[model samples]
Target: MRLLAELRRRNVFRAGLAWLALGWLLIIVANLLFPLLGLPERAVRNLALALLALWPLVLWLSWRYELTAQGLRRDAGAGAANPVSRRTARRLDQLTVALVLMALALSGLRHFVLDRAEPRGEAATGRALPVGEAAVDSERPPAVPADPRSLAVLAFANLSPDPSNAYLAEGIAEEILNVLARIDGLRVASRTSSFALRAQSHSAREIGRQLGVAHVLDGSLRRQDDRVRVSVQLIDAATDQPLWSDSFDRELTDIFALQEEIAQAVADALAEPLGVQTVRVRRATDDLEAYSLYLRGRQLFTQRGASLEPARSLLEQSVQRDPQFAEAWAALAATLYVMPSYYPDAAQTSFEQADDASARALDLLPDLAEALAVRSRIAADAGRRDEARALLERALTLEPNNANSRMWLGLTHLEAGHVDAAAEAFAESHRLDPLSGIHVGWLGATELIHGELAGAREHLERGHALGWRGPASAWLLKLALHGSDAEETARRFQDWLRDDGRIPEAVRAVHHAVAPAITDPAQRPAALATLRQAVEQQPGYDWTTLMLFAGLTDAAIEEALRPKPASGQILLMMIWSPVDADFRAHPRFAEIAQRHGLPAYWAEHGAPDGCQWHGSPDPRLECGQ
Candidate 1:
């Protein structure tokens, strides 16, 4: 009782209360400001830990010091008897009250204003809605029916001492998924969806519900030097029950055999329940070093952008280590093919390398689905629509569960102006890889072109949430501008662009220009000027849609006719959209058709969705009928 009274008299208790309140406020401020300052998510946690560690120091200082009229001084038996101690106590009480009030206000603001201001629906929550709810929502497409034999193989936990071995763990699970995908009757979810779910806290039942799968596979890998231990379990997603579990201890040199053994065991466990009769596990490589390199390269390939060069290097080394590694060659071709999208200056060299790699992969393995898909992309870029479609069809026939093949097939269908077919293909691809932002974004874009505004908005928002910042952001802005609340949507779109670092500054500038015209018609001329400037400054990026939306059809046509149009796929797909109706009806569109090699392709095959070829004294293609 005496010590407690002494502490209160010295203002130590009041000082501690004030310190805690101030710390709370500081943590709240850090939480709000860190993201804006581009700090990582862990930075906030570190700040909280630091604040906790300083709490004892703050209390000790309060116990040992006194705030007097002469300023801070060492405590010398100061008590309630000292006027300075009483004054300091009162000040500390006031400060604590102020901090508490401020914290309450900030909390209220965050709960009522900030939270409410965020975009609504699944995107805001960053999770997919249950199928029943999503199917009933008019804004979203009907949910894909869950299959009884469907399975999702999640990324395995890496218990290895070296964190770099995480890629190997993920690679093992993905290989198992690939093996199961090749089966005749089983439906395997794409790696993107399964691996993405591993980061979330959802249970197996929730994940299965979200991904539309009936079963889930999870495992852990612990590798130390030349030895490894793997533990795996198969779960019934609907029941949240483990159906089978196993563990394997093997030498690192026998990793390939171990993978096959695990996959065969899983297949045997599921055979009776899933009606699966056989399992065929293809060996990717005989050399462990080459396989490891391939796994690392493929992991980097999935994370496009600045990682492409490194991915190319690793894949190149993998192929050099094993010339007959068809999968490595295919992965190398894919990395090179996508290099042009991120680094346009090296496009020609990259495409040539991609061609050589894809050909080698095909020569090594004639039935390689991935190589066929890469060749399909090459054909599509060269304006050989029929050839691309044929290649994609063959690839899909060989591996029906290949999401890449499905995506390429959709692009081919879109290029040929088969809107319904394109939509079906895109939807199927999205269903196969539900968490893939690319698939979702393309599906949304296709829906937008088909005039399904609600569905387009839903998918585009989901794509944006999934970290797809490329075409989806632009399409979302387009959807917003076309909405009833154009002004508010434009404002929100501008705010989003201002904060998003993933989008290029030049692209954001172009969107910034047009977004204003959504609310203020007087800004149209300025927006058009900005679009034109952007077209000249960034020839590698497609600006035709922006130009068309800005009412500059002639300039758009001219931009499309450039020697190397920005994106061949974008150029082809844009013509099918309702916004391009005028662009297509214009007399100059016939010239575009000819220059794009569409007329020859269409003549050899059949005409596109809205086009008809007229052959006589004057050879011309008529469209927009």
Candidate 2:
């Protein structure tokens, strides 16, 4: 009626809108200002949630307090300090405006000034980016059913009936596999790749064909009266012939040596020659209980992800059970150095403690390659470059054939700005352990660092192709390197981001920064826009790309990327390297060399006389020499 119409006056709507705006203003103040003024994250999030729900009520209340001609209405009255005149309403409105402005200013000043996040890498305690394997299209490799040696290590044939002795069976097979792995030029199937075909109806031919290997080793073991009986056979996969067969009886204590003996025999049967050194891992610990614990730790650690803490704790106990357990201590420390950034809340303290523990381990056993590697990692994270390099060199010197040491060394080279050395180290690691996700991940990442996404993609896809799908970096690089399917890439990036828990962080490195050395200002915006679009499609965008897209040239980037990694970048990007180094060589390296700008080259030369760089002054020395 008359009252309702007056409440609906044009002035009332404006006042309602103003009050709604005020509620939002209050919301901004409550959440941002309170937190900036010293509220906790939980408190800020809660406050934000509360204000979002409460703002409508705030608006309704504000609307109720507005004056209408028909009434001194609900929630509306003449101001206590005002005279009875039209100016009284104006005074009320003025008061409302003043309060709104004050709240906004305070909110802005507190929140904007205080709550800003530190740029990435600022949290030396928290970093999430990791290099990963690249991606590839699925093309089923053609079946290779030609004549070759083949054997299936059938789930140990469970002859004991007591599953507890399962490790004995597995241990026997793994020993045989390990022995076969040491042949000068053997094509033995890698354990994981071969074992993944377990329970499938793949014939010996099919298995051999799928893995691209010639021989298969089948084995089984049964324990009786603290003694185990094992039988092994080598099958020529190509011709379906059993070339060799053997059986042995041994006490439980003799099982370790027996496994190696069987492995050596299998290699001989496969016609693969063995080197002079025996294929036996030195028994670092005599304590059976500690060894068992280490084995369990290895089992759990291999699964990775949510198991990091539990595995880390179990590995720590292994070292406690036997302080001389170098492998256990080294692995535990390495896990700590890497795991915390993934589970940031709990991992930070672990990373700190790990540094001390790893250092102690290396001091206790200088011969322990694993411990040295972890110590090297700790040093690198602390920016002790020289110390880190020395530690890594020591570790590599001890275990030159170890996949882990090679991978870590390759990554270290990449960090030290030695692109050629990094690439060579990665290639060597990849050759030694091609099926390993770790090898593939670092190798692909090294390629990406060189701006060679194609090579990165190849290594990444090869890793993924091997049936390892648990890691996140592989997917992240795929999204970053491939630019055509932005929407699909964005969706894929979201899925990958949800897998944040899977990243195995070794340290928070603020390195691997993309250089800003492009001199073309005219192409800057286009390059920047493309980079931003790529970032926008990333799982988590980063500031590294800001310079990349902006095309800023660097005095250092030029020097760091000098001598380049054989133009793998141009080849992988399906583009050519602008400098002569793309397909030819560059000359900037020697001048940079005299000043100690770069380090010695570590690539595996087909044959080395050191005369490879005659025109250039020691390409292996100062200029990636």
Best by lDDT: 1
Per residue, candidate 1 scores C-alpha lDDT tens digits across 41-148 of: 466678888888888888888788888889888887743346677778788889999999998888777556543342000111122321111221112322765677
Question: Could you estimate the TM-score for every candidate?
Answer: 0.71, 0.52
Tens digits of per-residue lDDT, candidate 2, 330-367, equal 77877776664445445447667787778777677767
Highest TM-score model number: 1
- Cα deviation at 288, candidate 2, in Å, is 2.2
Which segments of model 2 are wrong by more than 4 Å?
A: 1-158, 175-191, 197-214, 267-272, 275-281, 356-365, 386-401, 446-489, 502-625
lDDT of 1: 0.74
lDDT of 1 at 68: 86
